[model samples]
Target: MDPILLTDKESSGAFWPVDGDSSLIFLGTGCSSAVPNARCLLQPSSPPCEVCMKSLSLPPEKNKNYRCNTSLLIDYCHGNRERSYILIDVGKTFREQVLRWFTYHQIPRVDSVILTHEHADAVLGLDDIRTVQPYSPTNDIEPTPVYLTQFAMESVAIKFPYLVNKNFKEGQEIRRVSQLDWRIIEGNSETPFASSGLQFIPLPVMHGEDYVCLGFLFGKRSRVAYISDVSRFPMSTEYVISKSGAGQLDLLILDTLYKNKPHNTHLCFPQTLDAVKRISPKRALLIGMTHEFDHDRDNKILAEWSEREGIWVQLAHDGLKISIDL
Candidate 1:
């Protein structure tokens, strides 16, 4: 779908391809370092998205700067076609993650959005879903399902009241945009409902001081697990994750916030790698990292350390995509 065009100014050539379906694209991947500037001590020499870096030449405090939080969009499709899709998390960069991302591909719709927690960084961009919920082909109506835990609901309701549409009834439809719903990760209650196509089993991992973030296991393709903003994996977390087919994993998208001795609870790069080994997830890639990491430099170090050491490891970035034959 790459259509070549003549760019008389920059290069005389540019390709505008009709972005196909079934591609897993990275919107952003930093813990809280979404919008980095001189204040971000962590990334003294981090890489910036080409487009974003281009504007750095302009005077700061006057330029229209945009920041983003950590989030992931898993597009399930083969070749130029896609069947279903799911949004892992909607961080503060919700709007920018879309605007910044829209520059590349056009996301016409979303099946559902699964929030990891209620942190402002993770859920702030939620309100923007309004734009994606009006293209439903089912029931001749656009419906976007929001899945979250009871704890998240309590926090989100207070933050996003407009999304609640307080005036609507249970079965009523509002402009074809479906309201949010509650999902039970652990319990024995005939609650609202859940989806297996997501292949996500709950892993209550610790985050910050007293907060807990949800770690999900993407089950459709190969055994892939996603856990960001977590310190240690609970025994229950391990048990439930092992249930994703055969107590084995193919890919584990983990958090590598820090890289040293430790912090409050988040896993440093070294600690994260070790966890991957213990979990025995054949292959694991670091996520939710800061610009502090030099993708090429650090990745080489990790590759040398774990290449043939019975496990595979690598660093992730915005716009990077991976495909598993499972």
Candidate 2:
């Protein structure tokens, strides 16, 4: 069933049928500086950025050019008919994305969260999770579990000290904040960990020459890997994701920031294509795009490329959802 077609009441809490079908939803698919860029709109020149202009010309619901921070939601349904909503990245634009996509999909709550890195666009929405996990006077609500590397944890501690320590001044005691349970993953650990009954292997990749970021390979019957902020992949990392030349991944969600040129901290279009070929996944969805790409135009290029390579590849936009076997 298409969640998009469901009425608000029909899609509400526990409304998704317990049919054992799991799916992946793109909550946001743009890079840190999301589409409809402020600069493009604020500046007036002879030639305007077509993508940014289009974002303003259409309703957000009808506009594929409209994008927020990069994030994904995995709706994992278990054998027992229970469901788990796993969120990847709570970015700066998290609240906006949630208001639109979560409400649209009728996602009741987030069961857990996984961080790809500590970048502002990746983790700044940590506090807004309170919207999903309401506080109970009797403290019945469990804190939402968040998984991240020690490095990321350290960064979070520094950025949101109150979140880590739960220390608030007397004046702020009445303020409601997100109830979060922090779980640390060992840096660079490749061993798989379990969440919502599925296994996830952390694939460490280079975000920059010195900074290490994590991607994840997850699922049971079908494997999916997500690496939203990677610039380079180590040989070991590549071997693990590709099954050491077996190319076992069913779906690969990767970063592709610019359309043509190289980027220092992100994969450019060519680099993304190169990585897609190297990993040789059965299918690929590009993410973390910038205003440089017009969704319809760029996807046409990907279509031709995919036809030639036999491995499907296309850009993922906010609110896009695809069912997957888990």
Candidate 3:
């Protein structure tokens, strides 16, 4: 398949793509704190964060300064002409994101969900899933399928006991909550798993020195690897995403928390570029940005870097959608 690039104008059409093409939609593209930080707006620093100030002036749809938690939606189009919406990371801003992009894209419901970790920014919005669950004529709740690592599932069980057990008081059953069918990704992290008729290979990477988070390699012909939050990749995982590895990726979405300086739990811009160079994907988009970055300015820097390095890399913004061959 040839490299697929959809201009912003080309992607601003109807909700669904052509019958044969799959699309990757960025639901949000900011770190846990998100862009337009509250402190910047409320507290007001010496000069105020430029991005956050700009965010207040422009409409969200027109503002690249406004970003929510890092999340993605895969509109998977099968050969049978059927479509499935597979979402990654139901974060703290899930509801707002749904209200904005989901409504904009006319996505009726989510077919499945994939979790990267148990962090609040990644899982706090689990409760919002009830809104998008398929309707049941009999009034019985239809559970949404969710896949995550065993460790992540354990954390979720602890954090959301009601969601896990569902044993409520006699009259409390009337109180609606998210009904989830949790499926843990057991055994080896490198092994592949199936969800909504699509295959995904887990890429286990370090969140810090002690904690691990999952990234994924998915799709058929136009393969995409996504790692929204990661400090570093293990040697084994690095080998998998490396250019010399067995399979090459068409797109790589990675973490870029800050413009400079290293952090303990997330990749800064320079490290992100280093990883992109090693992975050698045909195209790359950096996500998980902070209020420090002006999206347009940073994206221009990325474009220049791409020209110099010959690896097409850029910053991903909320609501940006790309059509890919699958």
Task: For each candidate, give its TM-score against the true structure.
Answer: 0.74, 0.91, 0.92
> Measured by TM-score, how close is model 2 to the native structure?
0.91
TM-score: which candidate is best? 3
Go through the candidates in order and give each one's C-alpha lDDT.
0.61, 0.83, 0.83
- In model 2, which residue pairs have backbone atoms overlapping below 3 Å? none
Residue pairs with backbone atoms closer than 3 Å in model 1 (clashes): 22-77, 92-121, 136-142
Candidate 1 ranges with C-alpha deviation above 4 Å: 1-23, 38-67, 77-82, 135-141, 168-196, 242-246
Model 1's number of clashes is 3
**What's the true lDDT of residue 135 in model 2?**
67
What is the per-residue lDDT of model 2 for residues 1-326, given as tens digits with 9 covering 90 to 100? 34432112221121222233888889999989898898888894568888998988976567789989999999998888799999999999999998989988889999999998999999999989988897675335688999998889999999988778865577765445688899987656446677667768898989988888989988878889999998999988888778446457888999999998898888889999999988898878889999989988887878788878877787778887777778
Off by over 4 Å in 3: 1-20, 135-139, 168-172, 187-189
Error of 2 at 190 (Å): 2.9
Write model 3 residue lDDT over 183-281, tens digit each, in one string.
988534458998888999888899999988899888777778899989998888877777778566778999999898889999998899999998898
Model 3's lDDT to the true fold?
Answer: 0.83
Q: Mark the regions of model 2 whose C-alpha exceeds 4 Å error after superposition.
A: 1-20, 137-140, 167-174, 243-246
